[model samples]
Target: METAQLQREIREFAVSAGIDKIGFTTADPFLEMKNRLRRQQESGFQSGFEKGTPDERTDPSMLMDRPESIIAIAVAYPSKMDNPPKGKKGGRRGMFCRASWGQDYHDVLREKLALLESFILERCPGARLKSMVDTGELVDRAVAERAGIGWSGKNCSIITPEFGSYVYLGEMITNIPFAPDEPIEDGCGDCTLCLDICPTGALIEGGRLNAQRCIAFLTQTKGSLPEEFRTEIGNRVYGCDTCQTICPKNKGRHNRFHAAFEPEPELAKPLLTPLLSLSNREFKERFGHMSGSWRGKNPIQRNAIYALGHFREEAAVPELVRILREDARPYMRGAAAYALGKIASDEAITALGHAETAETDAEALEEIRAAIRNIEDMQKEVPK
Candidate 1:
């Protein structure tokens, strides 16, 4: 069979397999991406969850032998949840990002890739193929851009004209020489809404992101969040979508075709107070299937505390007090203490006072002391 004909067949097969978009590129080193990555490293801008070394990440041949063509695929996920829950005064809710709404995307995309691999191997028994999803050695976004999947947006996401930026990307590198697709023209023009609207200013001027200041990255972290970024964390329990949500390109873009990516309202926007007391088994039973639970309950619970604080929900004070006084994990204890301080009611102040005296961990003790100081400052400001 002609390679062009085979490529056509593969494309048709991809559409049948529920892949929203597909594009092809040659096996070439991403030299420009390598330089940008180096700059990100030097400036401490990388999220640290990135998989491979710079050289390994930029070169396809390093991963697969004599890779002649690359296949990039995207699966769109729903941006809006059905009948989304609203947070109220007493029943404040924390959100999981749209990317994490449904089942773990890693599993969804990998299933498609595996089927693609099987389809190819059966047609050309000698065909050599290597496939990877987000956790792969090569960068999924860079591969997608080269394969004409979309233009890289200023918010550091690949924005497809059809699906906006709410798409999951994956790729397969093969030895067969398939025709490469043309790269898309840059469509961002002069829009900087993503940069201007980022709560933590993580988005730099030229499509670069300082991941250290990114709320999305911050929510996934296990430590007590920095005092500066705490206020900006808002009610996000896992990841953030502010940059994508504000983009003009994503206006009215909502893909709901894939059932696997449909969100359960209760899990996607869980109640904040109950999250503080979720046991390991309960956390797993409730959120284990979602991608947001990848970091386990620690980050989610910690972020929930921060979210409650962000709302200054007095209803959460008792739960925060219990966590501050009893949680074994210092980070969780510290975050709870901070949330108590943010509430700053008479009961919250009293709890903080008790925590300050009983807390033995130096770090948690500092958090308790800081909360007490903040409450004292607030009390001083009140008119006599």
Candidate 2:
């Protein structure tokens, strides 16, 4: 088959599989991106791996057992969610970051990629395929840009005017070299809304991000927050979209990704009150197919406590007290106790007693006591 015809067939198959945008590129046009990935890996900004040898990332011969071509694809996830009003009290809010308003993209993307691979194999017998998304070490965002799928915006995200920065990208490394598409020149002409609107000050200059300061990383990282970005995390329990939300391209567009990707109504604007009541079984059932399920319940609940702390809602105190004494996850216990203490309920003083003595970690114990004192001082304002 002619390479052009093969590429067209591949594109046709991908669209049939529900992928919105498909783009192809020569195998090595993304060498600069691969080089950047190596530098990022070496610099040690949360991605904990050694820099790949050039042979590992750029050389198709090294990356795939049977080297040939590169194909990259993106699925746009636009943001048109209507979160409930912040309300008069500004206490426990009803909302989620827009990305969580859908079926988990990892599963969606995987199924589509597998089907695409099967289609290719049927057409080109003996063709080999290895597909990956963000989970893999290959430079994904760069691949999307090189594929002519979109231009990399100043925020360092692949931006399509159709979907803005709200897109999930994946690629197939294959043994069949097809006709390639020309990469688009980057079109981020001096719009710094993404940089200016970052609450955590994460975005640095033109395209650099201080992952240490990124609100998204803070919510997902397995350890305690770095004391600074925690406040910026606010009500965001999962990923952060502050950058994308501020971009002109993301505003006022009607989001029309795959219907299967649409979120459940409760998930779209979940109440903190109900999520607190969720048993582990309920947590799995509620979030199992959603993006929030990927990191497990501990982080989600811990983030809930962080939001409660920021809101200082006394209504959350009872649940917080129970979590302090009984929750199995230590971070959940600590976070709940801290939020409860900030709410200044009578339970705060007693929970700190259990927390300080039972807590083996010296640092956690100190945090417990600090929360205790802060609440006690706030309690002084109450009339006798």
Candidate 3:
């Protein structure tokens, strides 16, 4: 089969298979991305979650033998939920970012990529192909940008003209030399909104992110969240979407093209209090399907404690106190202490004092002490 004709057939098949956008690029080494990644490494800007080393990540040849072309696909997800539940005092909710709204994109995109792979194999029986979603070695955004699926935005997301930045990216590498698509022109001209509006100042200029400071990354961590980011994380239980939400390019792009990506409001924005005591089994049964639940219950529950604290929700004091006094996990107990301090009620103070006496873990005990001091300082500031 002619490569151009094969590419045309693949494009049509992709559209029919529910791929929102598709583009092709040569399987050249991503030299610029390699250099930028090296700089990020030197600066300690990378989130430890990244899958591959810079060399392995930027070179397609490293991943596949004699890669000739890369196929990039984008699936648009909903940016806005329908009649989303609102967070309130007693029933305050914590959010999972839009990317984590529905089913895991890894599963959804992999299914689509599988279909694409089978289609290619049917047409050209000897075609050697490898496909990957976000977890793959090659950078999804870089592949998407080079393939004309989108331009890499100031917020470090691929900003598609049609779907804005609300898209999940995936790619396929093949030995067949499909005609490469022209790259999209950079569209985020003079946009500083994402940088300015980031609560934790994680966005360093345009197209650069300090992942250590990023709320999205912090929310996934297993340890007690750093004190500096506690308040800035607000009510986010999973990833942060400040940069995406603040971008002008993403303003009206609520692309709900894929049904699998449509959010369940209750799951996406869950009540904060109930999350405190979920057993591992309960957590998996309730939230396992969502991408946000990948790090398991600990991080989500910890972030929930932070959200309750951020809201200063007096209603959550009892639950937070229970966790501080009784939860076996030191991190949970520590997080609960911090939340109780933020609530700073008479009941919370009494609970903290009691927990401080019984707390055995050194770190948790220190957290209890710090929380008591914080409450005392706040009380001193009150003009009686």
Candidate 4:
């Protein structure tokens, strides 16, 4: 069978398989991306989670033998949840970003890619195919953009015309030289909303990002979050969607077709206090299936503590006090101490004072002292 005819059949198969968008591109090295990544690395703008060296990441041929063309696929996820849980003053809740609202996208996309690989192999015997999802060495965004899946939005997301930036992307490299699709033109004309609205200003003047300052990246780190980004982090437990949600292109584009990507409000926006007490086993049993749980419960619990502090939820003071007193993890204890200070009730202040006296970890003790100082300052500002 001819490659073009096969490509047409594959496109139909992809759409039938529930892939929202599909495009094809040559397996040529992404020279521009390589240079940009090198610059990003030099400027210390990269998120350390990125896999592979620049060369391997840019050159697709190096990843698969005789890679002649690449197939990029996008699966749209729901941008909005029906009957979303509300977070109030007393019953504060932390949010998982839209990306992590449902089951892990890695598994979802991988299943689709696996099916696509099987279809290709049956059609073309001896066809060489290597499939990859988000964790792949090659950049999904660049490949998708080059394959005409979507234009790269100013927010650094591949914005599809049909689904906006609310889509999961994956790709397959095949030895067959399928005809390539035309790349889309830039559509972000004069729209700086995503840049101006980024909580930590991670978006650069161009379409680049300073990943270190990004709240999305910081939320995944397993340590005491830097003090500066804490307030901006707000109630987000994992990932962020500020830029995507604010994009003009994404206005009114909410695709909730896939049941696999559907969110359970209780899990997506769980109460902050309950999160503080979840044992590892409980955490996995509850949230293990969600993509946001990839970094484990430590970061989520730590962020939940910060979220309670951000809201100054007085009801959470007891839980914060308990964590400050007895939590084994120093980061959790320290974060709870900070949260208690933010709450600023007499009980919270008293707990911080007690924790300060008994705290042996120097870092946690510092957090306690800082909380005490802040609370004292807050009290001083009020009229007697």
Candidate 5:
């Protein structure tokens, strides 16, 4: 089969298979990305969750023998939910970001990629191909940008004119020499909205990000969230979409092309109080299919406590007190202590005082003491 003809046929097959966008690029080493990654590592800007070293990540040859071309694919997801549930005082809710709205994207994209792979194999029996989604060594955004699928936006997302930035990226490196597509022009000219609107100032300049300060990364961490970011985390239970929401390019671009990406209102914006009491089995049964539940229930539950505190929901005080007094995880107990302090009612204060004496973990004990002091300071500011 002729390479160019094969590429055209693959694109046609991709459309029929539900891939929204597809492009091809030469399997050359991503030298610029390698340098940038090195800088990111040296400055400690990278999230520890990144899968590969800079060299392994940028060099496609390292992943496959004699790589000739790379195929990049994007599947657009919904940016807005239909009849979204609203959070109120007594029944406050915490939200999962739009990217985590529906099914785990890794599974959805992998299924599409598998279909594409089988199609290619049937056409050319001896073709050597390697495919990967977000977890793969090669960066999906870089591959997509080079393949003309999109341009790399200032917010570190690949922005497509058709779908905006609400798209999941995946790539395949193959030994077949498919004709490479031309790159897209940079479209985010002079736009600083995503950088300016970030609550924690995680976006450093246009294209760089300090992942340690990013709310999306913080929500996935197993330990207690740092005190500085607790208030900034707001009502987000998993991930943050401040940059994407603020981008002018994404305005009116609510791509709901895939049915699997449509959100469930109750699951996406769940009630806060009920989250704190979920057992491991219960949590899995409820949220296991969603991408946001990958870190398990602890982080989500901890963030729920922060959301309750952010709202200062007096109704949640009893639940917060219970978590502070009896939850087995020290992080959960500590997070509950902070939320109780934020509520700052007499009931919350009394619960904190009682837990302070009984708490064995030094860190959790200190949090209890600080929460007590916070309530006392607030009380002092009140006039008789």
Candidate 6:
């Protein structure tokens, strides 16, 4: 297959595989992105950065690794449901973001990516193909931007004007060379909604992120959360979408495409209590198929306490106390104490008393009292 013919053929295969858009680009290093990464790391915005983290996520190795031509694709996960219901949520009527409303996209995208690779392999027998989703360190957003797919929004998410940032990105690296698409000019001129609405101020002075302050990272990170950061976590149980929701580009985004984007049962406005009760086995059984669950059930479980705190529903007291009893991580335990303090139930009060007995952390002990006071205020129906 010739280059032009191959591009058309590959695009056809992508569309047939349920992809929304497909574009091609040549391999190029992202040296301009180096300073951005450096700033992010220095500002403590990175995760999984134990040591020796590669620059591939910001560099062009993604395209240059083994291939000369790159194919960038997107899978949209649209939502038709309303935002999750506010206050005392249980059962299905609650809320879920459109992205997580249904089957996970990682597996879906992977299945298609492999098939796309197979399609390429069949066309070019000697050509090697590499596929990447969110897990790769290569700069997917940059590649997509270069391929005329979209431009990176102020929030750092790819914004395809028509599809917005509510889409997932994937790539196919192949030895089969093809012409690269013309890069799209930045369209987010002077838009600050994504930055203005950030509750944690993860968006710094420039269009960058401080991962430590990012609610999404706070929800998924292992270990206990700082007391100062817990209350700000708000109602988000897993990841934070505030920036995306506030993006003007995403305005009036009615999810009519991507039928695969439906919520898992538990994820459809999960009860804070029931979620706190899930063990590793139960957590896996419930959220195993989710892209959010790959980090293990602990982080999500911990965030439930924070959500309950934000909800301040008396109905969630028993569940919160139960987690407080079995919770071991200082961060999670701390979040539990903070949430329980906000609930202020007799049951919660009793549990906090018990937690205070052996709990040695001075800050956590203070938060326990604060949690109890918050519960008292809530019980009195006082405005926070």
Question: On residues 295-314, what C-alpha lDDT tens digit does candidate 4 reach at each position?
Answer: 89999999999999999999
* TM-scores, all models, native as reference: 0.99, 0.88, 0.99, 0.99, 0.99, 0.87
Please give, for residues 1-384, the per-residue lDDT of candidate 2 as tens digits. 777798888888888888888988666645676666656556665334223554465555567776567788888765764444442243465356666768888888888899898888887888888888777656677778878888888777888867777888898988777767888876778888888888877777767777767777677666456556656778777878778777887776556667866756667656665577687788998888887677776677777787887787777777787777777666667677667666666666776777788877665666688788777687787789
lDDT of 3 at 29: 97
Taking all chains together, the TM-score of candidate 2 against the true structure is 0.88
Better of 2 and 4 by TM-score: 4
- lDDT per model, in order? 0.92, 0.73, 0.93, 0.92, 0.94, 0.73
- The per-candidate count of clashes, in order, stands at 0, 0, 0, 0, 0, 14
Q: Per-residue error at 108 for model 6, in Å?
A: 1.3
After aligning candidate 2 to the native by TM-score, how far in Å is the CA of 325 from where it should be?
2.1
Q: Give the better candidate number (2 or 5) by TM-score.
A: 5
10 residues in a row with least lDDT, candidate 1: 348-357
The alpha-carbon deviation from the true structure for residue 87 of candidate 1, after best TM-score superposition, in angstroms, is 0.9
In the range 1-384, model 6's lDDT, one tens digit per residue, is: 787897889888888888888888876566666666776677667765323244666544543555687789888776446554444444212233455566777788888899888888888888877788877666678778888889888898898977888888988777777898887788889878878888878887546878778887777787667767877876566777788888888888765666667655547667666776777998888877777777887777777777777666667776676666666666666778887676666777889989878677776677677776666676788655
Cα deviation in Å at residue 79, candidate 1?
Answer: 1.0
TM-score of 3: 0.99
Candidate 3 per-residue lDDT, tens place, 255-293, comes to 978888899999999999999889999999999999999
RMSD of 2: 3.1
Q: Give me candidate 4's TM-score against the actual structure.
A: 0.99
Expressed as tens digits, the lDDT of each residue in 160-253 for candidate 5 is 9999999999999999999899999999998899999999999898989999999999999997988999999999999999999989989999
lDDT, residue 22, model 3: 98
